[model samples]
Target: MNNPTKEEIGRILKSSKRIAVVGLSDQPHRTSYMVSKAMQDAGYEVIPVNPTIDEALGVKAVASLKDIKEPVDIVNVFRRSEFLPEVAEEFLEIDAPVFWAQQGIYHEEAKRLIEENDKVAIMDLCIKVAHAMTKTH
Candidate 1:
């Protein structure tokens, strides 16, 4: 995937109101928790999706992306690269505008699947880091 420009990242962060954070963590030490927090702090609604916990970062947690009925503008992933295919599969079915795989979590085959749909934006980038840069500008 090509590196997203700050302008592009800013537009996505500013425009995407509701985000589904997949593989979100129950523990504070995890990158999932940190990244999710960053998104929330940046003014995005983050629906935590973790089967092990019912809640995280004070937001109601759903077991999976399919469980959330509300509109999701972006589905940010924090899972392992090998597990990305499954997450991508589930996210593609949703009506979300974007499918974002976080840093170190790209699956070429999976990315191809998500991008095949012209309606959705398949991006490989860190949501939190993107927010930081966007905010800086």
Candidate 2:
């Protein structure tokens, strides 16, 4: 995956405040849950978007991006590669500033769609690592 510089990532994080974590799991050991918890503890308001669970992190778990009422600053994706296209489609339906595809996630077509229509920022990186890297500088 193409990783952005510490400075660039930090700037993006600083500019973004509200994040919708797609495919966020309820299990404590899951990547989604851990990342969500880290993000929440770091001051970002994370809205968990999980279909199976009704709540996560003591907050209501929205079934989909469409279920989120307010505008989000970023949509953080943790789903598999096969689901990216559909997720991107859903993302286009919403009004967000950026689309973040975590560590192992990436989709060129989805990236193109987001940039072409909404022109939102895309970061295919680990939010946790980004936070750690950002804090060091």
Candidate 3:
């Protein structure tokens, strides 16, 4: 998997404030839940996108990215790598500026699609780590 340059990661972390956490879980033990919570604590507004849940982290969750009427700065994904193509398709329909696959996930085609669409594509990077990295400097 191709890693985003540090500069690119910094840019994404700096510019994105409203993150749509795709496949975010309601259970606090899950990685998605933990990361989203950390992000919320870090001052980024997290919008949970999960079809099975009605809410997460005190915010009402939407069934899909398409359901979010507000602008999403970044689409932070927690789904498996196999689902990225579908996720990319949904992202294409929205005005999101960045596509972020979580720490253990990456999909080449999806990355290609997101980059070709003039959006930033970041894979296999923990959003919390990236955010912290930016804060240090």
Cα lDDT listed for each candidate: 0.81, 0.83, 0.91
Could you tell me which 10 consecutive residues in candidate 2 have the lowest summed lDDT? 1-10
Report how far off residue 102 is in candidate 1 (Å): 1.1
Clashing residue pairs found in predicted model 3: none
Index of the highest-TM-score prediction:
3
Candidate 2 per-residue lDDT over residues 2-116, each given as its tens digit: 4456787788788878889999888899989998898898888999998889888888999999999998988999998778889999988988867888887888888777778
lDDT of 2: 0.83
lDDT of 1 at 80: 85
- How good is model 2 by TM-score? 0.90
What is candidate 3's CA lDDT for residue 67? 96
Better of 2 and 3 by TM-score: 3
Query: Model 3 Cα displacement at 22 (Å)?
Result: 0.5
lDDT of 1 by residue, 1-137 (tens): 65456787788778888888888987999999988887787678889988888898899899999899899998988888898789878887788878888887778877777777754444567877777777831
Tens-digit lDDT string for candidate 3 (46-135):
999999999999999999999999999999999999999999999999999889999989999999999899888889989988888878
Q: Which residue pairs overlap in candidate 1's backbone?
A: none
Task: Give the best candidate by lDDT.
Answer: 3
Backbone N/Cα/C clashes per model: 0, 0, 0
lDDT for 99 in candidate 2 is 81
